[model samples]
Target: MRPALRTRRACRKLATALMASTVMLAGCASAQPAGTQAPASVSARPSPEATGPVAAVYKDLVYRSIDGTDLHLDLYTSAHANGQPSPVLVYFHGGAWARGQRPESWRGYSRFLQRGYAVITVQYRLAGEAQAPAAVQDARCVLHWIGANADRYGFDVDRIVAHGTSAGGHLALMASYLEAADGLDTPDCEGVPRVAAVLDFYGPTNLAQPYNGAASGRHPSVVRWVGDGPGAHDMDVRMSPLTYVGPDVPPTMIVHGDSDDVVTIDQSRELYAALQRVEVPTDMVIVPGGGHGKFPDAEKARVAGEVDRFLTTIGLP
Candidate 1:
C-alpha cells in the first residue's frame, strides 16, 4: 500500500482502538468586522508587498497596536463574497510564539477557497515584541474584530474557525477557549465570539508539560515569551491552551505525528484525554511516522479530508 494510505489506515485503527478503550476524546487574521468603518489611516487594499494570485485579497489591515506597534492581518477569498457571508478560517502561523510570519502563499490555501471558505491570516505580537499573554490577547482581538466587522467582510460571525500549527496551534485553542471575563480583553475588543471549530496541527497543548521542542519550558526563547522570575509557573498555566479546555470549547480536530520529537505526542494525547473528560466533540488523526509539520503529500491530503469532514460535522460549510 502507498505510505499515505498506510498511515491513514493506521491512524484509523488507532483512533478506533482509543475510542473503544477510553470513550474518547476531543479535540488569525486581522480583518475588522463587516460594517465598522475603517479609520483613515488603515488601508483596505492589499499592500504592494503582497504577492501571488488570489480571488480577492486584502493585506496589512491593522487589528490592534501596543506601544505604537501595529499588528495587521491578511484576508483572502475566492471572490468578493457579496450576497451571503462566507465562512472564515483564521490562521496563526507557527514559530514557537517567538518568530514566524503570516503565510504569504495565497495558493497554498486554494483547497479551502475552492471549498467556499474565506481565509484570514493574522500577524500577532511575537515574544520578540512582547510576551505570552500578548499573542493570546492579539488572537482574541482578531476574533472580536471579525465579529464586529463580519458584515463588511461577508463572513458569518457564527461560522468562524481557528487553524494553526505548533505554537500557533496553542494560540488557536486559546482563541476558542479563553473567556472574555478572564482578561483577554483590549480597549477595542472587549468580548470574544464563540469559535466555531479548531484545527490544530501538532500543537503543544500544555506549557506546563515538558515537551522536547525549542519552545519548551525555560528555554531562553520561551522564558522571554512567558516572562522570567518567580511567577513564571502561574503564567505558564495561564498561557497554556490545555488549562482553558472545558465544555465551552468548540468542536476540534487535532492532528499529530506519533514520531514527532519536537512537541511530544503526549501533548496531544493529554489534550485528547482532557476533552474526552468533558465530553466535547473531538477527533485525533495520528500520522504513524510523521514529524512536526513535515508529513508526506499523501498524508497531507488525508489531513485535508479530515478537516473537511470535521468542519462539515460542526455545521460549517
Candidate 2:
C-alpha cells in the first residue's frame, strides 16, 4: 500500500527542524553562503535540425551566470508533444563533482523522448572551479529556469522530475529535496516549484562518511568538492542530501549496484531508510552484481524496465 503523504506544512516544520540542527551538529561550521549570481542572458532557440523522436533540440541554453561563467543545458522536446505540454526530466551528469559534461549520448534518454517527455540535460560548475553548494546551487537554478520558462517551452511544470547518475544523482536528490527555507536556492531563481519526483542512481547520500565507509578510505574527489578547512567536515554534513530528508520531499526512486565499489550500496540503503521513516513514497532497486553504472546488458534491460514501471506508477506516463 502507498504510504499516506504528509501535509506540506508538516513537512516544512520537520525540514526546518532538521536544518536548524546544522549548527549544533557541526559546531562552529556554517553552510557556505550563496553567491551573487545572475540569470543567463542568452535566449533558447531551436536548432536547425530535428533528430529522431525529438521534435526540436535547443543546445547551450544558458540558465545561470556566476562570476563571469555561463552554465548551459540542452533541451529536447518530444515529437509526440502534439501541441500538448510535455512532462520533463531534468538530468544532471555524474563526475564525482569534479568532472563530466552534460550528456552527449541520447541512447539512454531516447525512450523518454519517444514516450513524449521533454528532457533537459544540465551543465554546472565542477569542483575544479568551485566547492560545495556551488554545484548544488546550479542544480537548483536549473529547476528555477525551467519553472520560469515552462510556458515558453511548453513544459509541464507540475511534472518536472529530477534524474541523475552518480554525482549527478546526488545533485538530483539535492535539487529535489532542498527547499528555499534551506537557503541553498540561488537568489535569482528562487520560488521554483518542487520537483514532482526524483531518480537517484548510485548517488552518495552521506558526505560526512568516508567513501564506502572504512572499506575505501577517503575519496579525493569528495574531499576536493567539500574542500579543506576548519569547516570542511561541517560542509560535508551540509552538502549531504541525507541532511535534508523529510516527509515533504518528492516521491523518490533509488537504483544502486550491490557490488559497486565506487559508491557503496549502503548509501542508497540509508536514504531508503530515512525516507521510509518519514513516510515518503520511495522505492529502491538493487542489482545483484551491478558495478557503479557498468551493468551487464541484461541487467541494464531489467533496470530500465523497473524505471519505466516506477515512472508510470508515479504518473509520469
Candidate 3:
C-alpha cells in the first residue's frame, strides 16, 4: 500500500540551530550571508526520462518515518522476489533536497536496474517542507523498511549499498554514518542504515563550510535542514561522514565531477581523505569536465562498475 505522504512542517527549532552554520558559510570567499542569500528557487523542472525495461520489474512502495511522517519510494527487483539474494542499490535524488523527486533522476537511475541489481529511488521530505534531519530521517526509514522487507524483496540486508547524488548523497552518507556512530552508544534517535558500501556523488560533507553560504545559492536549503545557528554543530557533525570515520564503515566509493558547480568536488575529497585516514577500503573516481548533472556515459558506467565490484567483493552479487 502507498503510505500517505506528508510534507513536513518547517520547525523554528531546526531553523534557529543553523544560524551559526549559515554565518560560517557566508564568510567563504564565494559565500554570502543568509540575508543576502538568494531566495529559495528551483531550476526548470527536468523532463521525465524514460525508465527503461527494468522499471517494469520493480514494485512501488512507501513507508513512514519513526514519527509517522509519510515518505515514498520505488523498488525494482528481479523477476521473482524468492530468487536468490542479490545486491541492492538504493538512491536518493538531488535538487538540494528542496525540489526534486526520485523519478526525475531516472536516466542514470534506470541504468542501474539493468545491471542486475535491485534498485530503489526514494522521495523524502524536502527543505521547503522541513529541513536537515527530516530528509535524512525519511531516507533512513526507507532503508530500514527495505531491510525489514528484504525477505519478500529478494535481497540480502547486509549486501545493500546506500548511494545518492548531491544533497541526496549527503543524506545517504549521513544515514550510514549514523549507523557507525551508533557504536558510541549514543541516543536511540540517532538513525542508521546498514549497508555494505556507500556511493557519495559530489556530496557536501561539511555543513559548516562556505559552500552552504548564503551567496552560494544553497544557504536556504542548508538552513532549512540544520537550522539557523551554531549549536547545530552537533547535528552537523552527526550528519558528516567525516565525524564517524572508522574501519567499521563499509567499503566505500566516492565519485565526483571534478568541475561540479553545485556541490564542490572538495566535498568528495574531504570524504576520501577521512575514509583513507581510517584505512577503510575506498575508491575515488573523478570525472573530468563533468558538471552538476552532466556526467558522461563512461563516468556513469564507472560508478555502476564500482558498486558492482564492491558488491562482488563482499559476495553480495
Candidate 4:
C-alpha cells in the first residue's frame, strides 16, 4: 500500500494521473430516504484544506484480522475538538476486492476527519488471497478491535460508521446486514461488534450474477471470494447480506452511478428497495452518466453532498 499524504488542494493531480479502467455510467437518480437538503451556501466541491472550525490530525495503525494479515488503517482525528480521539469512521476503499489500498485510492474522505471525527482508511485480505467470509471476518475483527481499543485512541464509543466505495460499498452494507462473524464457531467470533451505520458507494448487492461476461471472465474475483461460481455461489448464502435480514440493522445510505457498468445500477437499486421494504432507513443517490468513482466534477460534488446529508442526518458528530 502507498503512503497517505495530507492534501491542501481541492482537486488532486495524483488521481488524474491514472485513468481507471472500467465502463462509464450514463445517468443516476437521487432517492433520499431521510434528511432535508443542505442550505444553498455550502460549496459542494470544497478542498481538503477547506474545512469549518474543525482542524484535523492524521495517524495510522495496524489491526490484526482472523487470517493474521496486518490490516492497515489511516485514522484522522479532529484537532479543534478536545485532544480526545472523537468519533471514528471505519472506511474501506473500492477496487473490486482485488485492487486499492488505504489512502492510496481515496482523498475525499478527509472531510470526515476534518469534522472532529477520527476516520479509518483500512485494508483487508483480497479475494484472491482468501475465500469469501475472510474479508468480512477481517472487517468485523477490525471494528471490534477499534471499539475495544477506544480508550487508547480516545475513540467515541457511540459513533463508528462503516463506509466504502464500489466493492468497498458491498463490504460496508454487509457490515450492517450480515452478522459480525462468519458463524457460531469461528474463533474470536465471541462478543462481535456491529457498525452504527452503512455508507455504500456504487456497490453490488448481489454477486450471484456473473460480471463482464460469464462467471470466469469478470466475476472470478467474486467467485474466488465465495469459493464458488455461478450455481455454487448461492450455497455461500452466509456471506450475502441479502440472506440475513431482520430489523436489527443500522441506517444505510447508497450512492451509485446510473451508467456504471462495473456493478450495475440494479445493484444499488435492489438494495435500496430491499432496505426500504424492510423499513430500514435508507437513501439512494444515482448520478447521471457517472460510471465508477472517476465521475465528472458536477456529479462527484452531488454525490458528496448526498453523503454529507446522510452522515449529518444520522448525527455523526
Candidate 5:
C-alpha cells in the first residue's frame, strides 16, 4: 500500500478510537441571536497544553501587523513527520466574525497532528475591530505568511488546505478563491499561494440576501461586519464568496445542516450550484437534522469520514 494510504488508514483508526471514547469533535458555535453576544466560553482562549503533543508548537506568532495592531496564529506540527514536509491545515475559527478566540478548540483538531499534517489556527480582525475586506485581507496575508515560511516550518506549500466554519468559512473561501487581482491582499504580505483545497462548514455565500428570510431583516452580525453605510450593498457584493467563484478556484467541500437556521442550508446549495456551473470540483454533505454546527456525535463522525475521503480524493499529502 502507498504511504499516504497507510497514513490515512491510521488516522481513520485513530478517529474511530476517539469516537468510542465519546470525545466531542470541534465544530462552529451556533449563531448568536441578533442582539446577543457570543457566550464567554466561546471567546476564552485555550491553554497551551490543550492542543496535546506535537513535534513543535509555535504560539501567538505574529502573521500580520496593521494600523498599530498585530494579528497572530498558532502552529502545530505533526509528531509523525518522516523528513518529508507535511501538508498543512490552516484553520480559521468562527464566531459570526465578531467573537471567538483562535485557540478556542485545539483539542478537536489534534487529529490532524496524528495524521502527519501541520495545523494552524489564525486570528483575524473581527467586526468590532474592522469590517468586510479587513478580515478577508488578513486571511490572504495568512496564506502569504505560510508561503514565505514553508521551508522554515517544513510545510508543503503545494498542499495547503483552508478550513473553517461559519464566518471563518466565508473567509476561507474568499482567501482561497481571490487572487492578487482581487486587491484584498495586504501590501505587507501580498501574493498568496494557491490553496490546494477548501473545507467550508455552513458559511454564508451570498451576503446580499437577507439572513434567514426577507422578513427576518439582515443579520446583525453581518451588519456589524459590513456596516450599514451608503456603500453597504456594494461592499456586500464585493465581500461575498459567490462573487468570486470561478473554474480555477481550488476543489471545495461544503458541509451544511439542512435544518440550520443560522446560516441556512440554501447558502451552501447556492455555492454548490455556482461551483458546478463553473466546473469546479466540489462536494456538498447535507446533514439531515443538523442545526448550525450542533451536529450529533454520529453525524460529526460521518462528516469527519467524508472530509478524509474528500482530502484523499484531492491528493492532499
Candidate 6:
C-alpha cells in the first residue's frame, strides 16, 4: 500500500534533524566546505587506457561548465573488440549532495567492465556550488550529453542504466523518473535522454519521510541544499524523486540495509511498495545487518550479482 500523505510532514522534519546531527551516515557526510583544505591525497586522478581485455578509461572529460565551474566524467570501456557499442552504466557518486568524487579506481566496478559494459562515472554540482535542483539539473545534462555523443563514444544509448548510492541514489532516480519533466535551461545538444533502469543503494526516496522519530528541527545541510527561504517547501517537493513516480518509470532495483540507522529501512520499503502499486517491474534486497552503505564482501558480491541479473531481466545489454 502507498504511504499516507500525512507521512510527508513527519518525514520532512526527520530530514531536518538528520541533517543537523552530524551523524556521518554513509554517503550522507557533510559537504566539504570551501577553503577547507584537504590532504593532497584526495584529489581525483587521471584516466588510463586499457592494457588488455580490461577497460580503456577517459578521465575528467568535461560534460558541461556553468558559473565558471566545469562538470566532468570518466568513461571506462572494455578494449575495443568486435566494433560493437557497449552497454552503459552511468554512475553518480554519493555524499549527501554535498561531497564526493567520480570513480578514480575500478575498486568496485571491474566486474561490469569485464562483462563488457562501459561505465561512466560523473561529477555534478554540489551544495557548495548551488543547491538541490542544481545537482539534479547537472544529472540531466550528463544524460543528454551521453546520448548526444553515444555514437562517437561507441556507447549504446538505448540500454543505459543509472546507478548511485545514498544521495547519488536519489539523483539517479531523479534522472530516470523526471525524464519528461521540464529540465534546467542550460544549453544542451539535441538528443532524447532516457534511463532503462535505476540501481539505488540506500537512497532516501521520500524527502518528507527520511525517517521516523526525527525531532522537530531543521537540518542545516538540508536547508543549504533545498534552501530555507520562502520557496524551500516547494523546493523539497520539486527535488524529491517520490513526487514523480508514475506508471512510466523504468524498471528499478533497490538494495538497502535493514539496519540502516542513517536513512532508515522504511524509506526503501515505502518506495518498493509504491513501485509495486504502479505495476513497474521492481525488486528490493534487504541486507540483514547492513547499516547505511556497510555491507560485507560476500553481500556486496550478492548485490552485484543481483544488479547483473536485474539488467538482464530488463532486456538490457
Q: What is the C-alpha RMSD of each candidate to the true structure, in Å?
A: 10.9, 5.1, 11.4, 15.0, 14.0, 8.1
| Local accuracy of candidate 1 as per-residue lDDT tens digits, 48-162 | 4333334567777777765657778888864534456788889999988888999975677777776667888989888776665678878888898888777676778888889
Off by over 4 Å in 2: 1-49, 211-218
TM-score of each: 0.81, 0.86, 0.72, 0.74, 0.82, 0.81
Q: Could you tell which candidate, 4 or 5, scores higher by TM-score?
A: 5
Tens-place lDDT digits, model 4, residues 1-317 = 11121121211232122112100101000110111211111122333733443353333355553333445565555565478658777888787777778764224665666576666777777766654555665576567667667776677767778888887887777665555232411344334456778888887676655466763533665655555433343323334455454466788888888888778898777667767777877898888888876688888778778878888888765
Expressed as tens digits, the lDDT of each residue in 1-317 for candidate 3 is 11111111222233344444544532221131111111111122222332453423333354553233445566665433244675678888888778878873434554455555777888877766655555665666666667666666666776778888888888777677655223221122233347778888788877655543476433465666666555454455545556555666677788888888777788788778777877888888888888985888888787678766865676655
Clashing pairs in 2: none
What is the per-residue lDDT of model 2 for residues 1-317, given as tens digits with 9 covering 90 to 100?
A: 11223344554554455454443332211344444444443443555546788787787888877766778888888899889999998999999999999986455698888888999999988887777767888898899888888888898999988999999999999899888876656566787777999999999988777654544344677777866655566566667788778888999999999999998898899899989999988999999889999888988898889888998898887
How many pairs of residues in model 5 come into backbone collision?
0
Alpha-carbon shift of residue 239 in model 1 (angstroms): 0.7
Q: Rank the candidates by lDDT, best first.
A: 2, 5, 1, 6, 3, 4
- Candidate that would win on lDDT: 2
Judging by lDDT, tell me the better candidate of 1 and 6. 1
lDDT scores in order: 0.72, 0.79, 0.61, 0.60, 0.75, 0.71
Among the numbered candidates, top TM-score falls to: 2
lDDT of prediction 4? 0.60
Error of 3 at 291 (Å): 1.2
Candidate 2, residue 156: lDDT: 91
Write the residue-wise lDDT of candidate 5 on 123-143 in tens digits. 998888766667887888889
Clashes of each: 8, 0, 15, 13, 0, 4
Cα distance off (Å), candidate 2, residue 70:
0.6
Query: Which structure is stronger by TM-score: 2 or 4?
Result: 2
